[model samples]
Target: MDSSEYILNAHNKEEFPPAHTAEHLLNQLMFRMFGAERSRNAHIERKKSKMTFTLDHKPDRKEEKAIETEMNRLIEEDLPVTSEMVDRDHIPDGVSLEKLPEGASEMIQLVRIGDYDVCPCIGRHVRSTAQIGRFELLGTNWDEHAKSFRVRFKVIP
Candidate 1:
């Protein structure tokens, strides 16, 4: 979750706040479920978004549906989202630094979705998970050669 996405939110661009926040939560959910890291590639947008993760094998339909169910359950929990600034060196373990873009500040702002997720990000997010709406996994694709699976999702208000 250590990435420039959060900081990029401050720029007041066109990215949707709720969707962006949900992306963070979804990313963390992937990590929790599969012990996999965040998406190696992502394209988060208002209407729909996609995230690609490296997995030993692709998940079955049951697993994919489970992901959607769990994600929506978390959103309905209405957990609070908070942010705090911490020194770069003080970043907690399990947070990856690979996505931090160039020219990032020494102080990183971490966006926390309750106790579920705490990652350095600069994107705009909803104050609570309830604002994230229902998470729907629209589709999935697998690449055997790369051992990668991509999940496309959207939020239903």
Candidate 2:
């Protein structure tokens, strides 16, 4: 697991899949909105019922607003979220496949949001964007060194 902390979602399968998928979308959105990337040690604590990520930059209110808009749009659009089997060798050049937590098998499953979001993922998510329901930007803040920004938010189904 490369030593990064791992945790379980507070909710069971049904609740966790959508919430966790939203978190992954948030992770991708932040990257697109800004050049910053998410931390490899990222996790969504379903039990804690909170979603957070470590980022290289903190978005000001304006940026957060834009992100909130983009994210919610993604959920509302409910783009078809699909996955399939792919050979480990077929993984795209820039994507990282180093940490396939617990149940993720060597065959590898990848999730795609519409045509826009595509990455290697083991977590469950809505089959399409429509199932994502509505999303709101709860809040965000810069952590200790400004080297990381933590975002907390949720999706309303």
Candidate 3:
């Protein structure tokens, strides 16, 4: 379909498209590696971003390095980022509505990063992964009590 057929919701925040797009990649990577759900909390900024995921165990240094490696690999793949508007009732398989904000509209925008990842989102994003620059994992913190793993990172352009 044409771009005119797709409607995007009014975004509350003006995110740095590159960083925001990187967040999607990170979320998908976390899921694929640890079977963890997408981050429940996230702060995406131009210079730095953080995402918190619930996991059964903390990822060691090697695993952390692998996350960075895989993210860069995907970025280097230069996948196209596209989106479509879909009815809530007809949401595609593997797409979850659990992360949708409260009072969201019935028409949802599904953002797809090539064949690597797809999710319902209304945030700004780069047209392709090549625009994301380099993925850097600055640090991480694991809260044993909460089972929360918070990752701090940024992209170097």
Best by TM-score: 3
Q: What is the C-alpha lDDT of each candidate?
A: 0.85, 0.65, 0.92
Q: Candidate 2: which stretches are off by over 4 Å?
A: 1-15, 41-56, 101-104, 144-146
Q: Write the per-residue lDDT of candidate 3 for residues 1-157, one digit (tens) a residue.
A: 3435665556689999999999999999999999999998999999889999999999999999999999999999999999888888889899999977788787888899999999998878999999999999999999999999999999986
TM-scores for all candidates: the values are 0.89, 0.76, 0.94
Supply the TM-score for candidate 2.
Answer: 0.76
Ranking by lDDT: 3, 1, 2
**lDDT, candidate 1, 95-151, per-residue tens:** 776788777777788889999998887778899999988888999999999989999
lDDT tens digits, residue span 1-157, model 2: 3111333323234446767778777777776776556445444544323444555556678888888888888887768887765657888666676555555554656677777777776566778877766677667667766466766666676
Better of 1 and 2 by lDDT: 1
**Residue range with the least summed lDDT across 10 consecutive positions in model 1:** 3-12
The best candidate by lDDT is: 3
- lDDT for 79 in candidate 1 is 92
